[model samples]
Target: MPKIIVEVMPKADLLDPQGKAVAGALGRLGHSAITDVRIGKRFELTVEGEVTEQILADVATLADEIFSNQVIEDVTSIRVEEAQA
Candidate 1:
């Protein structure tokens, strides 16, 4: 089996209220070093059987189409690797 990791995040140009609120809270809590905190989604998928290139490609497509919204979020990265036994 193999695991696929997909990361999706808001585009830089967009305003992230969640991130801003977190950053403000961190500053108030004396964690000023943490200036920016942009939140994102990470999806880990474990394939049932042997993983092939086609499977990886399909995963990427799913990441683009199903997992993320192109309007605000960007598919930052997608990775596929063997899963731990």
Candidate 2:
């Protein structure tokens, strides 16, 4: 089996309130060197057979249209890998 990995992240111009809250907590916890933080999402799709270009393309479409929100997030990466037995 094979798998597709997808990564999504918030638009650079948009503010992430959750990430900001985490960053503030880190600062309060004595982590001054940590300047900022941002949050993202990862999705893995396990395929039943050999990975192919068409499958990859289909997954790319899913990543852009379903996995991530185009308005608030961007599809940062899409990759194929062997599924662990």
Candidate 3:
């Protein structure tokens, strides 16, 4: 099987409260060197058959329309991972 992976992340111009909280926690935990953190989402679509260009296109649409909020997030990446035999 092959898997289609979609990555969504908060827009650069927007503030991520969750990310800021995590960053603050990290600093408090003595991870001061870690200056920033941004939370994102990863969606996996496992394909049972051959991967096709149309499928990829459809997945791209789904990533933008269904998986992420366009106002605050962007689809950062799309990738295919082949299963290990």
Candidate 4:
């Protein structure tokens, strides 16, 4: 099986409230070195067949359509890597 890794994150043009809140909390905790915090999600899925362009495309489409909200986030990247020897 092929493994798919999907990284989802908020568009750069959009404001991330969760990230902002985490940053604010960090500041309150005296973490001066930390300036910003961005929230994102990682999803790993196993495609039940050989890794191919069509499989990759379908996985990306499914992730965007169901796993994430396109309104608040964008699919940053999709990587298909071999599972382990």
Candidate 5:
């Protein structure tokens, strides 16, 4: 079996309100050294039986189509890790 890891983040060109708020709060709390903070989502899926390039491609397509909002978010990265023996 293999695993698919998907990471989603706000588009680099757009402003992240949540991240800004967190950073502001941190600054107010005397953590001014923390210049920025960004939040993102991570998902891990276990794939069994079939391990093909098409399967992996489908997973990526599905992730982009459903899990992430192409308008406001972007797919940061996708990692396919083989199971440990």
Candidate 6:
């Protein structure tokens, strides 16, 4: 099986409230060096077939359509690799 990894993150121009809160908390906990933090999501999907260009294109479509929200979030990267045994 081939595994598809999708990473989604907020757009740079957008304000990330959760990330800001975490950064503030980290600073209060003495991790002041943590200047910025952006929270994101990762998705792992197994496709029961060979990894091909068509499959990758389809995965990209799925990432843009289903896994991520184009308004607030952007799909940063999508990788397809063989699953570990």
Best by TM-score: 3
Give, for candidate 6, the lowest lDDT window spanning 10 residues: 76-85
Listed per candidate, the RMSD to the true structure in angstroms reads 1.1, 1.1, 0.6, 1.4, 1.5, 1.0
**Model 1, C-alpha of 64: deviation from truth (Å):** 1.1
Per-prediction TM-score: 0.91, 0.93, 0.97, 0.86, 0.86, 0.93
The digit string of per-residue lDDT tens for model 6 on 1-85 reads 8798999999999999999999999999999889999999999988987888898999899999999999999999998868778
Return the clash pairs for model 5, or none: none
Off by over 4 Å in 6: none
Q: Could you tell me the lDDT of residue 48 within candidate 2?
A: 82
Error of 3 at 77 (Å): 0.2
Candidate 1 lDDT for residue 74:
95
Candidate 6's TM-score: 0.93
Give the distance in Å from residue 45's predicted Cα in candidate 1 to where it truly belongs: 0.8
Indicate the residue-level lDDT of 71 in model 1.
95
Per-residue alpha-carbon lDDT of candidate 2 for residues 33-79, written as tens digits (9 for 90 to 100): 99999999999889988988898999999988999999999999998
> Which candidate, 3 or 6, has the higher TM-score?
3
Which stretch of 10 consecutive residues in model 1 shows the poorest summed lDDT?
Answer: 76-85
Cα lDDT of model 5 by residue, 1-85, tens digit: 7888899999888899999999999999999899998898898888987568898798789879997999999998988888888
Clashing residue pairs, backbone N/CA/C < 3 A, model 1: none
Error of 4 at 78 (Å): 0.3
Error of 3 at 17 (Å): 0.2
Best by lDDT: 3
lDDT of 3 by residue, 14-77 (tens): 9999999999999999999999999999988899898899999999999989999999999999
Better of 1 and 4 by lDDT: 1
